[model samples]
Target: MDSDKDSRFIPVNDTCNMLEMTLSFPEQLEEAYQIAEKQELIKINHIPSSIATIGMGGSGICGNIVATSAIENIKMPVFSFRDYTVPEYIDDKCLVFAISYSGNTIETLTSLKALLDRSLRNIIIISSGGILEQVSQKFNLPHIKIPAGRPPRASLGYLLIPIIVSLGKLGLFNRYEDTIKEVIKEVEALRTDVNADIPVENNIAKDVAIQIKGKLPIVYGTGEAMGVVAERWAGQFQENAKVLTFNRTFPELCHNQAIGWEDASGITDKCVVISLEGEWEKGAKVEQRGALLDIVKGKGIPVLHINITGDGGLPAIIRAIYLGDFISIYLSALNNVDPCSIGGINSVKERIAPYIDKLNLLS
Candidate 1:
């Protein structure tokens, strides 16, 4: 009758087995890169003046990461839309990609419909199978299909590789292939430290889990990679550890979050602040993130510093993600909580079914 025996909590060994599949991403990247190179050879009649990716949850987070990473370098403005409608400025000159891992995601579907209505210049679809795929076929829009079965969060590689490849094909960036290769090497190396075989004494993730036990985690990051990586940590804590956590980006946090911390005395001691550090060129805003961490620590919050290691931008970000993921899983084990079950989310879905039916009928 013990819940720990439930299949949902797949044993650590099983989770490690699953990691093998997830880790195949590096190989997948090579294939994706080749496909993208071929796609680049095919000349499209027209290209959009701007780009936007529409999705929700993990799907949306990927878009945010890409947008932030490319914002400073991309010739056209890149945007991420989490809502049901495309921005007003997204006209015929816009390339709108609907990205939904489940394909049936309401927000993404709605946004896709809106973009179609506007006769957007170019449209791409990324999903497994659902109404999104059907729409893509109906309109002859370009689409990428990902294998189904794994949880959306666990399929980060499938979701991200396509985006990276697509952008490369579009001539948006020339360094993606090398960057991806470097990241893969870095991530493979990290497996030794984060792998299940590594005992708690020497495992960085296990060490982090022990520190964060029973505390409210507040993750902070800077720039595109670290910021999205921070958000990923918060999401992993919620889904994998079933814990309440929050995340905010640097520089921006200084504008508001710094002041709010003053009144949080009761929770200060119980809070664990994780700062994600990355390589920055001269004068980059991230250079000052360490100062922000010092300020938070001075306010009595426990602080943990994690430096994302790698020469390439993509690899550094991936390392940060894998570390956070391992930490979340270990934290769940330390807290004796199931890492996979989300009964609460299922119950909410059940409660909404009746209303959803009624709305469908009205529509």
Candidate 2:
């Protein structure tokens, strides 16, 4: 372990402060649940045949988790759009949700405008307050105002709960009340394991982060929760740790990616495999995970096994996400990088602004 702390890393004091704020996710989730219950009372007049959630970056990732998790359960198709345009197919039969934590995200705002222009049915907006909230009010669209003043990634609970509660309101899901309670408990439990005060030796998240340092992370998950958590981990690695990471769902990976592993002999040494496990109905998932781990290990790649611990689906999922978030932060510290800054992203946006302006003018 590198004992000398790097000065370039987000200051240890800052990381501690952020960790304390991150620990509030459980309480925030509880508050969101309460607000969602009240919001659920609002009538949804038009129950669209399908659902589409529009957002970008962290906000879009939350929608991805929700849409992916609800795939099997939701009777209507649920799709998430991370781009600037709403799908042309979205119309009166679609429930379009424009979710932007900052409410200023360019892509989400663009998609929201497209949806509004088409007069999409059952349009709802979730934002902290910006142009999105203003437009929602002007159009008389159903809007949920979440508490502001946190990073978009940190506000996952706020961004996600409203969508789930709205689904429950629309009669799409019935067990949300029970699920919310379970998820809260799970997040509270996870704090003991991932909290900043916990020494590195005692912290599972820290241990995993240390193991993956200097190596590309490849996260694999089996069931719905696992898949969603894997994707979250990948995003955390990208935004928090500024590390390259990839994710893929199981059973699907078995079809093609599994075969490509043989040709990856050299690069395999530079990669770490993380397997995410959860309570899945399909008993064969465990077998598949075991086989994949064995295959990768045989190829000389290091492997990390993380078991999702919690009672219900929502809690288990939240626990996994919490673990990933903590691990990514620790990895940021290990890499000697500021976890809160995204210079590359800012530069990319700056360089693209001129083209965007020209495109807007052309449109």
Candidate 3:
């Protein structure tokens, strides 16, 4: 059966309406922009010499996007910390965005406490509601409260746009103010072209989903923008499509991972390589990407090239991410899995709850 055109399969498989959440991404960005514009300007005594964003999982990807985009745009160094401990260098002069959609992620909450204990005043909290929200209220720290009840992954726009707008407001990032409007329109147009109602013949996402079905997907992203987008692809494929997927960046992959294909007689047949070609890639990196893909293809592994659209930087990243999200959901339909549920992750969290509670890390 062609799951792409099977009207019954999609509705029956998508029990939790994740398709609705994925389709609403453009609206989410629109609303997030409104919310960001309404926020009061943050006041800091000293200019930030460095920037750090603390988060994990879905929420953490926002930081990854920012840190990567900052490479060529922002003057200040940017870091994404996914652990419980704060870097010793994050002092009062480093602007920190501590993001937790649930506000209770153990690592983010622990690090938030560490920042507070150190009397760091440059912290900005982004959360829906949880202990992190309570702490923000208790300390009167600048907090951007997003709408509650969304899965962190589904709340990407809410978790990300505020941080971008905030940085732009502070003069740390200058390109976002105008670029965001264009991104909003572009993403909305993409949604129309790829939504489930569109036939597989007309939908590129569905076509890709059908091609990669039953194969292990290895996503290769080039440059800072697509590197993060590649991570998003792998994560969405795992959590939404309920399959094992892997991601690595180019140039870096050339240094080590490319050699793994030298003896790929058995492994090559079961895998598909998806290369994200970012418009921002330099001439040298583009050559490296082409050479690496050629080597992989020589090993008999199938290759799919997705030339990222948009004028590079934030625009390209957002568009690539939007397309990947749609592809993941379409894949879920083919696999007959509910994209919204993560049974394995939930089981692990439940199993670890007792140990985490005993530690009293929050205290």
RMSD of candidate 2 to true structure, Å: 3.6
Question: Which regions of candidate 1 deviate over 4 angstroms?
Answer: 1-43, 71-73, 281-288, 348-363
lDDT value, residue 201 of candidate 3: 82
Ranking by TM-score: 3, 2, 1
Stretches > 4 Å off in candidate 2: 1-16, 37-43, 71-73, 310-312, 352-363
Candidate 1, RMSD to the unseen true structure: 4.7
Instruction: Evaluate model 1: give its lDDT.
Output: 0.72
Write model 1 residue lDDT over 91-130, tens digit each, in one string. 8767667788878777677677767767763777778877
lDDT of 2 by residue, 266-292 (tens): 797799999887655356777777777
Listed in order, each prediction's TM-score against the native is 0.85, 0.87, 0.94
lDDT-based ranking: 3, 2, 1
Cα lDDT tens digits for candidate 3, 130-231 = 878777777788888899987787788999999999998888887877867877888988988888888888888888898888999999999778889999
Please state the error at residue 84 of candidate 1 in Å.
Answer: 1.5
